[model samples]
Target: MDPLSDILSVLKLRSYVSGGFDASGEWAVHFGSHEGIKFHAVVTGECWVAVDCEAPVKVKAGECFLLARGKPVRLASNMAAEPISLQFLLPPTHDGRIVTYNKGGEFLSIGGYFTLADGQADMLLNVLPPFIHIRNEPSRATIRWCVERMRQELCDPQPGDFVVAQQLATMVLVEALRLHLSARDRDEVGWLFALGDERMRAALSAMHASPGSPWTLQLMAKKAGMSRTTFATRFKEKVGLSPMEYMTRWRMILAADRLTNSTETLSEIGHSLGYNSEKSFGTAFKRVMNYPPRQYAKL
Candidate 1:
């Protein structure tokens, strides 16, 4: 019940590469705000990435960038170039190699997106920065490796190519978050920050590991080796939610995952998540997800 892994599992991350580009000279591509996150990698050459209200960042080969806030961004060979709409530049190709060759200084780059459809996705992702840049470093070998693997998987296909590519993309995300967490300031507050706290981590692990348990303030405080009042205050300060609220949130996410991916009955799902009855679980699910479990399962 790793907290980060649990969050990702509940979020149901779906990732795919839009296309690859081999361009040179002055070219700019605008990617509009999307429902999920976006990423770019410099495979062979260098490029500039500009997010709204932020200075342009130069990324070279072996480096990657992530946009978490669904903000519009522009990637270009030069800042002054008239940009081309990414939609036109990389038209949707259901099943093919999306490679484009252009004249000028050759620059090979890969771009992709990660989508999360879970009702609780925003709550989990709201803590992340709008943009995260991973530079080429000895410690970032795994990130570079994932990027290269994804590039090869896209450029060539074998058995289970989609699954393999998606897995590699997920690895990139995990590594990126790990790096960001390591570098984040101590004052920064979020899920990762909560995980960094010794007391909060223990309480969170307990909740995640045993979601079916009847978690209470006293129980969580004991788990954190603190008084009830101290634990409650610190938990809210770090996680931005009360203990029971976070528990309910996780329970709903777990229930949603079960509903969508399993054939288990409502009663079974509810019982597994500590709900007293199917009706109670359905009410909670509807409140959190805005739809009943039965209806959402069909969706």
Candidate 2:
């Protein structure tokens, strides 16, 4: 398989937001939830982030956090400590505007928002500890450089700097994820480790290559060179879904994309995805997505 294509297929570039702030203050940002992922970096100063949880998380410079499920969250400086200068990243909206605040002080920071295009991204997300701190470590030099470049872009505000900054910030996010994966414990077992396994990887490849295929536990187990019971147990333990369940999710994901990007008839899409009829596909799609395929397609 083409690793590059595999990587690109599972990852998507969203939007990046970076800024500097002086003094302690609150900033409100508006972001619509998409079936995507989000990564935030505290490039400079120190701040606190609160996301529908009790209290806030104290995040220092060079540290990063991810909201892989695209939940809405709030970020602010730590008022209890010294006033923080801060910067952040987020996914771009249709208007290309990021909601934020600068309370007039010396602060520098950068942030990027991205979507996981493939299953690999989900693997990477799973291995990351709640918050990955990259402070005062030589291994974090690359992250430091990304932070510095973001500061320069914010300070200079040159032509197209906004675009350039966002692109670089996305790169930084990807690199950070790569670093995290490399440093993860070898004994760590999760969907990520499963994906790295030759047998499991091959199984996943088959499923993704043909979500509509009439997949069976025995067939999948044979493909993975394991007993059916072992394959089912292992697949469930790692993926949190049965093989058939995962196939359904995958089909829905593809259906959502097609609904948004294509003009195919519902019947055609349903049949292509292995549904016996458009009505059956529509029923399953609604059960999973809470909207009929045709209605969802319009959105």
Candidate 3:
């Protein structure tokens, strides 16, 4: 599989279409800091999104913004509009249903939050910008489809609304990240850009496709078609980790998923990732996860 698909497949991304809002006249809403990644898509009208100390971003109809790190942001009809805390506005048992806020206004939007099941999401996804904005244009057909499907599903709930909406939200996130990555400079020194490089892409695909492989520095360099020193330097420069470091981390991440989702013995899991013994695998897992495999599996 491709690098982006490989990373996302193991991340176990799940999205929830939480209630949305429709506001008109003069109004503002503060969705304070949250843990899950949050997003808002402008379905109609326009509004300004203001994060602390930054200028407000004007979001017109058909535009969308994703708060990848769940940063605190305020949406307002105007810069000076007094805002109400979103925490106070929603009902106590706010089910995952669309709700209009300050009804009778022009700005209309659907919003939601998503979570990554993988505990190592920060390490794997930190290369992304804090916020990703995608304009509604022909070039962004995938994003447009996600936004439209999510809006349609949420507005008119069906028998399997939860599953359908969640899937749509997942697609939205993937498309958003793809667009974000494609917009960056080709020479950017990050894993996101590294995924686009032919040389680095070959190495990454090799590492991901076979985490259990007894990959040596020479073998990895050969895969990238570069000398050992050149490969090491470029790998570190682009991916921010030595090749083996990434491999070990990836193995641990895969091990964590297996431990959580499967009924495998510790030794079996260890050997699957090229560990000789349960003790060695446990040590590595603890170092990366700050917990033993047995303990983490229960969580």
Q: Which is the leading candidate under lDDT?
A: 1
Whole-model lDDT, candidate 1?
0.83
Taking all chains together, each candidate's TM-score versus the true structure is 0.86, 0.64, 0.90
Model 1 — TM-score against the truth? 0.86
Sorting all predicted structures by TM-score, with the top scorer first, yields: 3, 1, 2
In model 3, which range of ten residues has the least summed lDDT? 96-105
Ranking, lDDT, top scorer first: 1, 3, 2
The parts of candidate 2 lying over 4 Å away from their true place are 1-13, 22-40, 44-58, 67-107, 112-142, 176-199
lDDT of 1 by residue, 1-299 (tens): 68888888788788887656778767888888877788788888899999987999999999998899988899888989988886676446546344563653478877777898656678557988888999899999998888788778778878887788777877888888888887778878766779878899999999899999988899999999999999999988888889888888889888888888888999999999998888998999999888899898888
True lDDT of residue 169, candidate 3? 82
C-alpha RMSD for every candidate: 2.8, 6.5, 2.3
- Give the TM-score comparing model 2 with the true structure, all chains together: 0.64
Predicted candidate 3 versus true structure: per-residue lDDT over 66-179, tens digit per residue: 886667899988879788998777787878666667664587788988777757678544776667778777778877777778878877878998898888888888777777
Which model, 1 or 2, shows the larger lDDT? 1
Q: Which residue runs does candidate 3 get wrong by more than 4 Å?
A: 91-94, 185-188, 295-299
Top candidate when judged by TM-score against the true structure:
3
| lDDT of the candidates, in the order given | 0.83, 0.62, 0.82
The superposed Cα distance between candidate 1 and the true structure at residue 208, in angstroms, equals 0.9
Give candidate 2's error at residue 75 in angstroms.
6.4
